[model samples]
Target: MITTHAAIEDNIKRYKRGELIVPSDFRGKGTENAIKKTLSRLAADGTIKRLGHGLYVLPKKDPLFGEILPSTEEIAIALAKKEKVKIKPAGAFALHKLGLTLQVPTKLVYLTDGNGRIIKVGKNTIRFKSTTPKKMALKGELSGLIILALEELGTDQIDESTKLKLSNLLEKENPIILKQDLKLASAAVHDFILKLILNK
Candidate 1:
């Protein structure tokens, strides 16, 4: 068996240059204490970042830009992956991603099938709100994003320009995927999406 220190070092190589690291990732790789010690050492040496309570990431650097920390969305997605859970960007973040808005919300929200938690990275605060499986059905789909953005702004708040923006976005999505996403949206949002795509 490899030594404790060596096991942690070898495991670090498994992550990509900018990938996030979580404890559960090495559950079976080595003894809990050994892995903890190894990771602590790396963090102290500035070889890796301690993002939060049990979150860490291999920081990426650019020659011109220097260190580039992971974005709130990236960190959230990584956490979901490590836990084998589903998470979809919600509210303002969704609208921003879909090109419907330019404002970046202070708090990034994600509807998740996993338990709720918050992770703070600099000025970005990532929040995971536990939601039902039904809501997470389209986690990675564009339609899911549309629904969240629409819900956040509300039907009454959707201006003509915003609707047009959504129309253009829907036009670019694969027809089959659009149909699948429509099936997963709420009834009102489903009708709205149909109207947008059909140009009605």
Candidate 2:
């Protein structure tokens, strides 16, 4: 029979290098304490790097930079998993992710189905804001992001250049998927996405 550490190690081998991991991911695999002990040993071995409280990651090492830290998105995804909720980029971060904004947001917000929580990682702040079911309906989809980005930019504020870029992105999506995802948006956001799609 495989030992607890061996089994945990085997399971960890499946995670990509630099992937964030939490103890909850090992649920049903072993006792909570056993998993924690195994993780502690692995962390000491430098096989995994411990992040904030209860957060660990298999660091991605670069030849010149040594171990690279995980991105905000990676950390946010881990938080969402820990909270057992779906999350999506919100406010200026959504526009930034889409290359519409050159400005990097100092604080990142994610609309989540879970309770609001705040986490500080390095110099950045990650916040999860509880949102209605409709706001989170397409949390995992491309269109959901478009809605949030447009909401951040507002219709009048979106310049011609931004509209062109947004239009081009919508052109690449499947019509059926786009139509389905748009249903999750509010009426105003839906109208904006429709305009972007039709104008492309």
Model 1, residue 92: distance off in Å is: 1.0
Top-lDDT structure, candidate number: 2
Best by TM-score: 1
Q: Which pairs in model 2 have colliding backbones?
A: none
Expressed as tens digits, the lDDT of each residue in 9-72 for candidate 1 is 7888777878888766677777887777778888899888887766788988899998787877
Q: What is candidate 2's CA lDDT for residue 194?
A: 80
TM-scores, one per candidate: 0.76, 0.66
How many residue-pair clashes does candidate 2 contain? Answer: 0
Please list the C-alpha lDDT of all candidates, in the order they appear. Answer: 0.79, 0.80
Number of clashing pairs per prediction, in order: 0, 0
Q: Please write out the lDDT profile of model 2 over residues 88-122, one tens digit for every residue.
A: 88878988887778988868988888889887777
